[model samples]
Target chain A: MNFSSPLTPTPVAIVVGASSGIGEAVARKLAHEGYAVALVARRADRLRALCAELNARPGAAHAVAYPHDVTHFDEIPALFQTILRDLGRLNVMVYASGIMLPSGFSEYNFGKDRATLEVNVLGAMAWLGQAATYFEQAGEGHLVGISSVAGDRGRVSNPAYHTSKAALSTYLESLRNRLTRKGVHVLTVKPGYVDTDLLKAVARPFWVVSPEQAAADIWRAMRRGKQQIYTLSRWGLVMWVVRHMPSFIFRRLRF
Target chain B: MASFPSADRLALLTNFGHSIGSVAYVYRPTHAEQIAELYRSAAGTGFTVGMRGAGRSYGDASLNGGHVALDLQRMNRILDWNPGTGVIRVEPGVTIGQLWAYTLEDGWWPPVVPGTMFPTLGGCLAMNIHGKNNYVAGPIGEHVAQFTALLPTGEEVACSPTQNADLFHSLIGGLGVLGVFTSITLQLKHIYSGNLKGYAWASPNLRQMMDEMESLKADSDYLVGWVDGTWGGSGLGRGQVHRAHYFAPGEDPSPAQSLRVEAQVLPDTFFGLVPKSILWQFMRFFMNTPGAWLTNTAKYVHARTLDHRHHFLQSLVAFNFLLDYVPNWEKSYGRGGLIQYQSFIPRAAAAEAFADLLKLTQRRGLPTYLGVLKRHRPDKFLLSHAVDGFSLAMDFKVTGGNRPALQRLTDDMSRIVLDAGGRFYFAKDSTLTREVVAESLGPDTLARFCAMKARCDPQSLLQTELYRRVFGSI
Candidate 1:
């Protein structure tokens, strides 16, 4: 019952979408916390900047930038192997690489929705499956995936992004159920409107949280061994109401 | 400087304690973006996570093994320092000592500071430490303007009183259960000179002390007292109180400013010291006995007559002279160790509760060591322990069979505190039944906490001993 003691250090943490936004923050946090961080992102400049920052620390442990597109399955083995080669071990993999097509589902391009599915769903699965194999072989590992609060339920606008997150959440949940006894961990994180570039581009009114605050929430959920959590706790209540609202009353209002 | 394997490989290589080994991985992100990436990776791996700021918390409040430990020390940078308005924006790693050195020169001091000087602003927010000034300034949370945290969803969010209010409330005293705190903006209070308008008073009984404490709460800016708990009969629970105020700016600085004058008391060597055997004998008999009154009374008079504040000696050093002289004195307790039982009971029941507490201690014949009582104000910050009541903190040195007796006393006292609708402070806790914690701090709060965890960290990535004891494993 005492949670004061945690398991052990992870050899390597492969953070997807380490270019910017929440991905970049998690990468920095993990690397600083003693994980040999593998920064996975497309923007080489930004990743290199982060690597330099981590390396510049007076007694920094280990961190590096790996420019790999999550959408490319062929990059998984090499990207992960490179982490093992450089950091000496691999234990945690985070899927934070994501893109949002903000336009209404009806107005957005069909191709954009497909790309969202491909990058968020298919691409995440490719890397996550590889991570599962790595952890299963070692008999211990953790997999973290980032989802959106929009995934709590369907919305009139941006149905594709919401659907992608909701689907991702379900996939992680199912994966956790399967891996619960295998020493492999799967976590799904759902955040409300984060004050990231993507959310900043939208016309959000009431629910907007800063990236740092969001990171703190993520850190807490992970620390408490919580299977799931909302980045901002109140969003759970908001979702509760949204899920239970009467159809007649709900259909008339716009969130 | 000590290096260990990653969380996964740690079990294979070394043996760590239940509390010490919980750190699976440790990350120190310089920027907020990197923390997001760490969250992303940790979520997929299902590794629990925790944040550490200077790691000054005496116990395991900041440690979580088999999980990632986020170190915010490297991020110690002053993002903004507005000397004009006394508002400072700093990373979570900024230490109280660092902040004090910077602002004290400008005639300002941190509104509150715990006994230790090395704790960080983030740690302060996490524990919500209160000082003697708690009666006047309230807890550290009330002065916080805003904080940015990195969440498990790889989201970087900023929360303040006006924005994301729930998060703001939870993070203040949530014990890092919510997230890794990054940067914080806090409002510093204006101060005059470092001189403290000091007054020393003695109380003959618990009621007299409580009466003086009630008055001190309203009239003084900083107040604290030392109780001679060993006193029994008419002198039982008698003590001395010290109240201090900030000297006005234009007041004469000569009397308050004796440059290097107070250094004369600094001990160059242990020329004459009390031996362990003698101290043990004293503790065994006269330590908490009525005969100790004469010794304590003389000690107070001697301490009161010390040279007042001087130019060279800073306020921080001047305020804690007693601590400087006796270092690690607690080790004198032999191997039996000790436990500090601190409680907060509503002001209405304080007199009777304290009287009952003393009687119980006396009946048990346990050493009624150093007892301190202070006044506190009510606050709205979630997880805040402050209440409009009287808080009593005592350190009991244990002997051979005293542990159980202490536990029983604590349980009885906890019952009184719970009955008065007050809660125990987490930072100074080793006891306090889970049921009591649940009852005192509504079980619904844990439900809400669990539901939030269920939604965000469905993989149960975070785990701490305290969480396991109070909140079951996911």
Candidate 2:
């Protein structure tokens, strides 16, 4: 109950897009590990419910809901400070907000692609950029960005989604290189076919894992100080083979 | 005109010593209404406001990292003054230098002042600063007649010893968290002249120094001891004691002339030759361990042989404000800056506890470059650090390589102080834990302070890096 020790205040984490899927699971996991979690998302009702569930657990650490739309770039700076004020100190920030819109196989939809890139890439940059600046100054923190195995190659389906994932992975890699010497750790998580609402249209998805399983793998990688990781372990081999395939042969292939 | 909400701009604010810093959205308000409007704008906005006055705190007390910092320096205004009664009313941003300069000609002086004259009255009251005469005058808060403050809850209230007494006691030492001072009325000390009869003597060791101070407390108006922290063996804690007494009526033949502002201004040159502004550049050459050892030894030897039992007449400005004598002297500590570890221990355990602390720093080869010893008496403030004994402020030079070792040394020192029933001053502190604060304050006092905070700031709108570091977001 005494929070006076600057040497060891309860660790705090901010999980963006924590209303559902891997973000919510990671928030719950972080709270269980004794981190005061700030659940950030656009869904106020879902975040409120999640906060209640996380706060009900018996511990000094709990959850606070910060309903926010990540596309509101101007609000990120103030919101970041507010969360820091409420949580005391920040140790980890997980950018798990992403969206996958349905697109026709043969038709190109700029609207869908634009929305996908806006939520998936731009939002992560705005939020994680703030975290990066804070962590760099403090000399220590953790950053986790959720990418996807779909980014490994130019796939025939969901071009915008794959492009967003590739951009996120590269951005995380650049941050890792920039912050590795500064005591901050950046982790890029590439999960394959997670069973979340984002994948609702996919029928009989291959090697599909539950959201909790994917979150657990990501948490393990973060704890291990990994720069990049693939959920379920087997996806790493699949992605490697998919990436090395000849370009002419890959263009003619279909999933 | 810039409105209260739009006045904010990103800024990096550092403590006076430059030892610690933070980046925040800073807003400088010129009137009380702007502050009140700022609070309204911050209501339910998730960001907390930290009050800053001249940014003189040596640590994070004035820093609000990643939040709003309300700077009050521009609000300075002398609202009222009565030369006969020696009662002065001023806005919170007025500095000690301005106060003394404005009233010295009238034969009045601030009741209590720190070693530096640049700190604003708001900061002095927030920290309840002490002086060499603390054993007699208590802290500056005791001299306060009344004050008006605006709380984070959008309510302004007047408080004094007889009215809103609880707030009067807590707000003065609250570190500017409970509310922001709008204006303060203070009672100044009546003086006949600006000169003080001074005496200097050397002590063989810690025990002798304390004994001499105890013997001189009744007759002397102000007393301070300078310790050679690098000394060891039988000469450990060896230092010099400087005592001063005010000139009685008619004792000074030229009272009118001595009380003039020109008579008290500190000289800008050394012996009418070398500029004191560049003195820190020369001092930097001797900041290392070997150089410090040599300088400290030479200083002690000089004090012992030449200044032993020295007597002379000294101006009030010369007697105090030694910190301002050497401008940018702290910068000589290098890029890492410096941290002062000051502990107030009860008289019963002062000698042993301070001896252990001095020895611990010596054993680690991190002897303090400067050690100041002062006598203190218990006060009525809620979070008072004063003890009916002694306080030793040790200044340690920090560097990139020795930070880890310095941290360990402070940790060990904190344990010794805690075991001896000592308390810490937030203004001078860079390191302290919640457990230490809770143990020092006890549950009853902590609960009362927290209760007052809740009543005054229901939404927890006021905060600082120091507050969060010591009390968290609770």
Candidate 3:
């Protein structure tokens, strides 16, 4: 349907790394809210499956799967442009994807740390870089990056993972500050433990939340145009204590 | 090798029941040329190919066991739209839900749609789906102005009512046995607004339910019902009769009428889908037959009080697709998934046919998981399911230890339906045999369809597992 009579164009949103996990849920939720979604992910089958499920719902809008790997930083622009061309408009860009590997300083693996930074920091920056420019030019849009609660405080156990998220968090904040005056809202979504296959190993999870719940919280925050969100609400308090704890005491803590 | 992309080579498909199938390959083709190439290659390799759209057919209709399956879901695109003419052209992968989403804003909607909106337009055409108002609107094929199909021989054939009429009719209900539908031009139904004024008439017996349905058929713009199939004795088939029509612009809706907003299109109204968490999937484990029976009974009782006219004004979404109120609602059926069996019986034998169908399940203590009844009338499509009668659809939970019994139950019910001058819808049917299919369709219609199939797909490259399972006699 043409949005000619309406002041705004058709609402479009792009979810990078939507093949599975939280990114898939966010894409589905947004499509349910009448936003035409462009699902970007490396696995074409998963993306296509998710897109098909979204479009098949009784009250759904269009969802097209754009097979892509955000790690391929150079191609992010082409991906966004294709979304604009195929979906007709752009209103939201959610970089809700990253890579994490568990390792202590003693057993630190070279490749894991390299990939962690490449995806969590450099890859996110590359994708958000394109989103920030496009939204600023459009004069209205929402840019979101799913950072982690781990970013609030550095941990000795996984320095690279923590630092990569911290960098993503800082980058998102910088983008928010710069884009705020341009009417483009940038949101940093930080979640604690989410039940996702992305984890390298499973543990008895604490405050374990599902991706759909995380997506819903993020969706609510984005709708309210909130600058940052700590999913599950309780995670906000948990992160607050982690952020406010004395440095010496925190250094000695094994948490 | 044409460089088929696959991090995991086998693209497996699972249904609502969580039943999984691993195929030789899965390809998401962007164009018909890709399908032609695939068919050409399959011919060379002697690998039977099947076309899949959405893969929501509840069974293996879209699955190709030990063969190559083409995933066409990614080909969805609304190619063209003419608001005034209500004629829209879309790729075969375009879904019925998507068709309504695009056209509803322009006050146009597809004339025929199944209960759930998950099935793709191509899938619906392949099944020739009928809706609540089938008695008046006919099957989806009637609303299709034309369609293009990529035959197994690599021929792209365009067919419509006046052009390639034989292929047009056969393809409507040909399953994937004809070929892959490439692009479709559909004629949509026009509506004044998204609002529907409706009411539910409560019935206490099968006789009264069918009687009320017969009387209401001529008056209602749209009609469907929910049957309490597990209710035994004289109260068998007791349920509610749903009737509705699009409210004319500026028409005054009664205060008693509940307002429903077309989901995703309009803002939330008094009637809207409640939010659910990810936990809902795991929580649906309580969806057993007994659990379903309790819910169904409660729903039926609640519906009984709203007899006569509530004068409710509902959004098209709330009326036609009330099933979507609970997101991923089918998951409630739990790990086994929901198996839907819908039977269409000529009005002359509906009373006896539906009674026997329900009684068989009731005797076995299998709750009809979900029972929906809709009035139907015939269309000219060669393999059409509607037959100037009433069609009743019921779901059976395919949980552990129930598959064997369910199979037997389906066999007994199929025999009863066939004997009572009733036909089965291939889309919802998973167990109909080749002999039953020939008997149900009659000799002439079956023979003609086979001849057409031979003419178009002589090598049977387009034939799927479901086609062979249902019509192997051909």
Candidate 4:
């Protein structure tokens, strides 16, 4: 279907974790749809590439690369200010930056698990929190972040990763509760088996969706102003069973 | 001055074929000054530069190896639009499809667009692409009022019919050489309705098909024929000619019905509802020689069975972008992919040229699937592929072992086309020899083109794998 939007000055979308995977695709996709995109990521090189690719599309709004690590949450305030100063406006904040590492009970590493919490939970809180506040002040804006289906269940393989996502999902819900009173919309995106660079070494799953598709789903959910969504139809079903399963059955089943 | 995209940012890029290249640098400059800055930077780095639109070029035309490639898709914006005159100025990255999408509601359309609407406006002008109505309207370049070409030395020169006339002619079909097209202002056409009145007529042979195409051209504003290449004897190169005319509101009973286009999405057919990659794989196998021939034959036979012609009113999208529904379907052309060869022969020599072209491919056992024929009149866009006659385009699946043999087959076909007084289009050309190019355009044309380049881009900053392949680097 032909997509139509008002022919006013373009809106701005700050896409964090845009250096790779879903964020990269979102930055490009939003730029094509007339959203001036500011790409944020830790890797300057990757963000630069994505920024170049997005900027070169004809009739598309501008895309700029802003390399900033989410782990260094303090820097985001200045980064958002610079984005506002340059792009003139902000309409959406998409936080797809997070880390995950597989650690079993015997081999659990405190540093790796703590790093995941700091990046996924603390980082999301700082960045998305600021976006929530800004958008609430502006009276209209969307705040979207990538949580995971792992949050639905405490997985033994990567408990830290699951806990971080669950924490993130709760933080987003609480933010949404507070922001709804004011004019901000918060969306939590939970993806299952997304074919990203992070999943390259893993066995190919039957329903692994591409980052491009994942980005499209997330953008669609954000546009529809959904509070939360499980990307891809099969994933929604898969997550449903996982989320609703009796704790007695869930604990016994090693996943 | 703004910096160009770094080497780390520029990974190997691919288009249709197996050919891939890693540009040392890739840049997306939003303004003419930024593009000028990129050129200056390339000079200092001792690497040449090339322009890449949507990277729709099937071959290496847009691929730059071991050099800087300027990705211009970001410099896209509607610079100006005069609704009254139908003159719209757009950045190079805007796709022809976008132009149509935005303008069709206003009952206006770009005068010329290639079969697919994905290619950028700048690339279309560079290739001087032709539409089905080429016999009457000429190429896209003719509709272009002017464009700002950023020269290598940070000069943003305006090239049009009346200004910088030499550079204008050379740059028209200059294949992204001379300079980068930063801005383009085009004249659009006005149509009474969004739908086209069309029909598919079955032709028994190559000669009859060309005749049918000519007849269709005379009456219809847009004309294209699909020639089947499977059968060898009397039915050789036999196919269906699909002719169409823009509905003149008066003739169409419900002209106002199409004031707004119907939903662009196709309903989920049983097969379409399947996941995309699986559907793409299915289409690939479904388009193999035997399968495609059967479908084409069935279509031809089915059309011939009818005593009276059946006319259908179709939307512009239904007519032009029928292939777009199957996204990434070309990937199914096998792991190696396929190459599309479109040769333009003078109308007088077309019938004879087609026989030889058919014989060459048939004898080589190269399956010429998806054959398209179109009538055209010549345009003065120096590198324009349109001829004062008609052209036939076909896609040949490329196999690993048959690639060399396929090149030989194409080389032989090139000789036949050149002998019949025809030339190749650079956009689909991955195997065009320099000798044929020089022979077709004459040494004077190439020398003149090179002279313009040398004078404007002294450092030879603008070069792509296409330039290196078709024309040796300076």
Candidate 5:
């Protein structure tokens, strides 16, 4: 979580969905790592506050505040243009903005599910596409998409959120393919249960990772040029067991 | 308009693995059926498919331009891990980093990992990546119990030393020519902590250093030496030799116990990667008289004198994990990038040929920042790069204007290697000619590789740009 204290000469980072949860933590970590971060979120006030706090730090005067909803695809272009105008070139872009709706399979809410899909899938595509455009032009950049271990396999409990993340994961994979030749690295950051606001409304486990630790893992994955990394990497083994559960025994078990 | 998906970028490197290209497509096939479907679709079409694991390769070996680079990153599912047997089966995309991350926390460690811990199991098997402990553990192919390879003929065949032995041997170091490796089973090592009882020694000259390395090979579990590449004459090869041995079980384990350690702090960061201009300027200075030799000797003496405490040092995985800090540090060399020249010379001829190689480095005026010398055990795999010899791996930061000179140096070094029956590691190759590859690896070995390719991928569907380099288009 305190990954940035020892390093200097921060790179320029663009964090989409920096209002809360993993996005906020990523923005903070990137800034701490000496990156001149551009905070992009829906709420202008929240971003401004984060930027102010970053600037207040010993060596974070370069942190910039840019509030914009990632779902607003039409506004993404201007956002990048502004970023380039203010900061020159972007080296890292993290898409941590997402939403989750808790509901059983039988009693699904279309409205809630659609909203989750919008923020998690469509929003990711729009922002990622924008990032890809810049990376292709610059011929080098890193695109990190915050995903979840749940995306590994669709769970019956949260089908909508699972499907959206799974799709986003695939899209990032495709984007990585196109961008790799251009020297652009695409990373899919998949975390397990985390102590974040998004999971607050749902039932959670006691062993969930803290926001800082999750951010650290994401940062480490990007540094390693890992295309798709399981945060805490151990979670990959846990999810492996969860994913390979036989349906007969799996359906009988309760979460 | 053609939509180049990310998964399809691997094919671009099928024609010339070293050529400049961008990743345009990537595919992740979680299931075997998906991989088979991809293979079938690309069978007749001219589209190339290159398998991509962790992008740890220093050269263009893993890159494929204008084709789908099938990224198996998501395929990293551990199918089975038997602690009692030390056999772990996983998808081809699982990397050594993941292996260590998952297993080391549980008191298990991978026996071998190259300088970098980012390559996938498939990439390791394909490139036959070796490590510092190669003298003890051998190349990655030796640890691999078996693998399921996807041939261009769209067949899923499980190969092993005892089963489909030829395919298994050819596929391991075949550089992905045999087919797409979907899964691999390997033998894992047991470990107590991330600490090592290690020591470093300073050698004065090349002959003395070579003799010291040979003596250490008799007893050391892990051995690697840092050589002064810029220095020539009888005093050349002098630097530091590091020898590490794992404490016996239930013996002297570090008191400090932690499953996960914090990230190792780096001298730089992503935002402040060393500027290309600065590196070029430094290279110019380092290439001048008394620059590299003096600096390297100083570093060697200083490093050799470090106090060894509990050595609560990072695990082999973390110790080698530099990229985890400066994410884009490689780009510090800029667009033209740099090249790594790693060659293996028979231990008998190492003293002479390595001396010649060092002389060439001085003659060509190549600024080699790092010179790594390792003692390797003879390998059993057909296309494996490790030989019963001394291997030297060095990084040359190429200035675009001086590329031709670097190539000339490489060509001369390759000739010395060919004459000495030494082989060049294809994984780090960017300038090795087809003839050098054939001469060094042996014509029969190359013929066997060609025969296997003809048998499985008659139309040359099982291909890589690396294959096209030494063997031409099938």
Candidate 6:
């Protein structure tokens, strides 16, 4: 039993897109681990409800709700400073704010693709860019961006979503390369099909994992200082096979 | 990543005057060992710790902003008390209110107290606070017999006037930059009764007021003047003076009852009618310039016509802790808060310097609402703000529109004060610049103080916003 003294400071973590899914589960896990968690998402009601629930647990660290839309790129800098001021300091930041829209195989709406790219790729850059600057100056911090295994290859199912994930993964990798020498860790999380709202459109998704399981995997990888990870571990083998396949043969595959 | 597993929650802390504020990681350590542990943890980390006691300063003296605030309020304990010899040893967190409440029944009182009794003894020593009797007894540091402290380097040492004399004098006024005070031993004043003979009189102007205070210093134990900052021209610096004297050995007929602890507790109501807690709400209506002028005029008129040359007996608490009479009275200044600008000018230059300052305020249409006048004699502390002169403290209400103007005004006032060979008090400052502090303390004294800081805290881990603002990485 490790009882904390009254003078002990609980580490602070900020979880974007914490209104639901992987971000929400990660917030809960961090709170349970005695980390003061800041929940940021577009859904104010969901964030408040989650905050209340997390705060109601006895001996849990404090949780605060910050209602924000990640697409509001200009607001991220000020909000980031406000969070640092309110939470005292920042030790970790998780960029899980993303969006995946359903579309027919024959349909190609630029509006849907634009929204998906805005939330998944641009939003992550805007939010994580702040963490990068701060962590670089402070010489110590953790940055996690939740990409996806779908980024391994462009499938016939969704082109924009795959492109966004690929851009996110490449961005995270570049950040990891640049920040490694500065003592800052950047983790690129490529989670397989997780049972979240984003996965509701899929019918009989194979190897589907729960949001809690994915969150546990991300936390473990982050603690172990892994630069990249595949949720459930088995997806590593599957992605490897997919990446090695020739484009001429991959074109014949259907969802 | 480097981690602080023992850090406490984040807090937004403000000064007692509600003037300046900041956010920091606040920690409350119960024992000296915990403070040592904190020092060890923060050794290589980029976090600086500022010591806070009761948070009674009027400015940023206790604020760390973006760092750690080591609040010693929870370390309060009366380690030992010798009522027979009027000596007591206590943890740094013991408040003046607690000390008085515990020893009043034994016919003992703190030798040097501020205008309020809520400040901790540690904070009082840190600022070297003075009282109405400062001219006679000097600041609180003069009454400290000895103290033990833990330096940021994890060195525990004892200091007194004879042992580590330089460290003793510097730490008392170091503004909590060198070390953390663990136990403080002080010599208390022995009294025959809790009641003091009081006398009240009004000075027609600033010159007469200074003369009266100078003449009354020998006969009075405590003398304080309340200046009407709203007055101008012929009536400039006009105010009321209240002098108190302790009772002789056999002066009081009921010394036993008068010395009881219950007799020293301030009443919770105004004349047993209105609850003092709610008076601030009513006072908010008079917080504006016109309202303050009207109120000051009325108070002066009442004092001159009815209470002039009044002689009476008053309790020690009533005479000393007037700032605590109305709880949260600062709230009346509104959310913009208020700041106090106090300057200690040598007697030769006080009358002229104070007159210039008062006239400048009126000319700028920014007169202070309340003004306090006190006589002080020089002390041996390294950072001493006292002189063989008079100190005038003025309170100004802050507003968004007047913030820049207030800063400019303080800058101009600093020039007039510095020209007159005056000093600045850290406890009541918010707008002083590094240049002003450098000129006030001189280079040699500043170098000596910084050398001591480097020796005691080699890593420069103990710091506050005031230190940064005034010293700027010295």
Q: What value does the interface RMSD of model 1 take?
A: 11.4
For residues B77-116, write the lDDT of model 1, one tens digit per residue: 8888887788898888888867876766565567887765
Error of 6 at B192 (Å): 0.6
- lDDT at B191 for candidate 2? 92
Give the winner by lDDT: 1 or 4.
4
After the best TM-score superposition of candidate 3, give how far the Cα of residue B210 lies from its true spot, in angstroms.
Answer: 1.0
lDDT of 4 by residue, B1-474 (tens): 333334244344666654322323457777878777666666755566778888888777887644667788887788888778888999999998778877766767899888788889988888887888889888888888888887886787898889987788788788988888888989999877778777877889988989877766767888888888777787878888888788764765655557465533334454646765456778677566787778678877976775224678777777877566567767877766778888999989999898788878888888687788888887776666777887888888776467667777887889988898897788887777677778887777677788887998888778876786567777
Model 6 lDDT per residue over A1-255, tens place: 122211123578999999999999999988988899999999999999999999999878789999999989878876876677556567799999988898789879999999999999999998888778767755668999999998889998988899999999999999999999988999999988899999986766888899999989988998999999999789999899999999889999985
Q: lDDT for model 6, please.
A: 0.88
User: What TM-score do all the candidates reach, one by one?
Assistant: 0.56, 0.78, 0.62, 0.63, 0.60, 0.70
- Among the numbered candidates, top TM-score falls to 2
Q: Model 2 reaches what TM-score against the true structure? A: 0.78
For TM-score, candidate 3 versus 5, the one ahead is 3
- State which docking tier applies to candidate 3: incorrect
Clashing pairs in 3: B17-B336, B17-B337, B257-B312
DockQ of 1: 0.01
Between candidates 4 and 5, the TM-score winner? 4
Task: Give the candidate order by descending TM-score.
Answer: 2, 6, 4, 3, 5, 1
Model 6: per-residue lDDT, tens digit, B205-244?
Answer: 8889999999999999999999989899899999889899
- Local distance difference test scores for all models: 0.69, 0.87, 0.77, 0.77, 0.73, 0.88
Clash pairs of candidate 6?
A7-B6, A8-B6, A8-B7, A8-B8, A9-B6, A9-B7, A9-B8
Predicted structure 3, TM vs. truth: 0.62
Candidate 5's residue-wise lDDT over B1-474, tens digit each? 233232222222211112233433457778777877777776656556666677666665665433456777888888888867678999888887778766665666788887666678888888888888888888888888898887878778999889998888888887886788878999887765565556676777777777888887878778888887766566687777777776566653442354344322233422577643345444445443366667786787686576342233444544455335434445545445567788888888988888888778877777576688888988888887888888988777666476667777787888888888888887888777677777887778878777888887887755444555567776
C-alpha lDDT of residue A118 in model 4: 90
**TM value for model 1:** 0.56
Candidate 1, lDDT over the whole model? 0.69
Better of 2 and 6 by TM-score: 2
